[model samples]
Target: MSESPISHLKFSTILSKLRAGINASDLHGSLTGYLCAGGKATEDTWGEALALDFTAEGIQDNPAFPQFFRQTRAQLDDVEFGFVPMLPADAAALETRAEALVDWCRGFLGGVGLAGAGKRGNELSADAREIVKDFATIASSNLDVSGKEEDETALVEVIEFVRVGVLLLHSELAPASSPRPATSPTSRSLH
Candidate 1:
């Protein structure tokens, strides 16, 4: 029998689904840090690219800043997923460097059918809202949000929106390489 919608439902389940099969070692603690802080995500191949730290931990300790960054490196030591907003300074810095990218992402995904046109701008739609409520339980399989609040709706929307933007850019900016046979050894390789 097919799985019921309830069986497939995922309200606050972001980490488990998002980080499933993701290696613990591959989850890095920072991106900009990897770029400037002498740190790097685990792995050296495709996995490495995905092992980035989305959480702005540095800004969390301060209050003069507004929230900037969200997301974090999945932890193998524990199991859970939660949202963490970056401080204003960190957010400002990120916004400065990736404002265009962020804007493009917001625009790209805003219309992809995630965010609504009503009161809850960042909140999920009625259909998706239920799924978001159970996000915490779902993400608990691949994340570590021991001390953070369980707020996956906004984070989920933000990430999905950004993903859409990135995907759109890829479709438009990525060079069209010659198609290779599926069975070719190099078929899966990326330049």
Candidate 2:
């Protein structure tokens, strides 16, 4: 399907709407459960933080995509973000920097993939799900997922759910283009 003419709408707005629609209380409760179940490193906290931030901030900058970066940073912070306590060159900072790069790349790719899918249609496509899966994989790889860890699986699922949910919400909220007026000077010009 042709891309909807919803140029005036912002993707951030759509994401916020979708996040708001979700059961936050339920999500938080679930996260707590996961955390109690040894999923300390799960991304649920980060996802919650980022989703909240997105709702609070909306889209500050559109073309520059600062909202996206800012929201991404919010999520990153929950993961001991950017090596918080020290300046660059410290081991923690170095790890944070590396992680940030990976996270940013994954986030961008997921966003782009979602946007492409949105342009194509309203319904979620397999390709779109694959893109989200790729996002989850990237997030999972950040930790030790090779050992059959339950925490890792839970974390990845949360991240993917948030990503997909955000994309789906944004597309749903996009506004249809304004309808053009029915009459024009040319229409009345005929003698």
Candidate 3:
């Protein structure tokens, strides 16, 4: 996949641009979670769901946000999202970086709950359940990547893992769009 448009953005910058105080990961997770959970098509419902986490801000109606929503949907709907999960590459402080990741996972799980992913059958697939459990573990556990090289390696691996799991779940939950059948033309009669 092409280098993600969002790759250049530091997690902080993304949050600012989106006018959302929530961590970038969580915001992304919420959006993805809602879509995967079979949330409705109305943009308002998506906005409201995001608001469940940030009541006051409520996902601004500004151009950037719409663009973000559009882009996110496109990514998910296309070949696959590649699941970057909104972590910052340049965060100088390890703790801060870890905190952002944890917040993101928390937000993602919250989004899943809000979207009611498993509410239908009251069950999540085994794979999905494992993924959720992993996310929960990641959210609560300490992140120590060891040395610089190892940290980079670990981060890359985790990103890949998260991307794959999310994509699989998305595919399972959100059916691809199909063309609408042509409607029959109205009959006209002349005397």
When summed lDDT is taken over every stretch of 10 residues in candidate 2, the lowest stretch is 182-191
Q: Any runs in candidate 3 off by more than 4 Å, and if so which?
A: 1-11, 17-19, 42-45, 52-61, 80-83, 90-96, 120-122, 176-191
Off by over 4 Å in 2: 1-97, 102-122, 143-191
TM-score of each: 0.20, 0.23, 0.71
Model 1 residue runs over 4 Å out of place are 1-150, 178-191
Q: Scored by Cα lDDT, where does model 1 land?
A: 0.25
RMSD per candidate (Å) reads 19.4, 20.0, 12.9
TM-score of 2: 0.23
Between candidates 2 and 3, the one scoring higher on lDDT is 3
lDDT of 2 by residue, 1-191 (tens): 52322111244245446554423222222222222112223233334423333334532322223333333333323322211111112232334433433454344443333334334434544444444455445544564233345644544454444433333322332212112211111111101
- Give the winner by lDDT: 1 or 2: 2
For model 3, residues 32-123, the per-residue Cα lDDT tens digits are 77776566544445667555443335345444455556666766665434345666665455556666677777777777777777564336
Candidate 1, 44-97: lDDT as tens digits: 221233333424443223321111111222211112212121112223233332
RMSD of 3: 12.9
Q: What is the full ranking by lDDT, best candidate first?
A: 3, 2, 1
Choose the strongest candidate by lDDT.
3
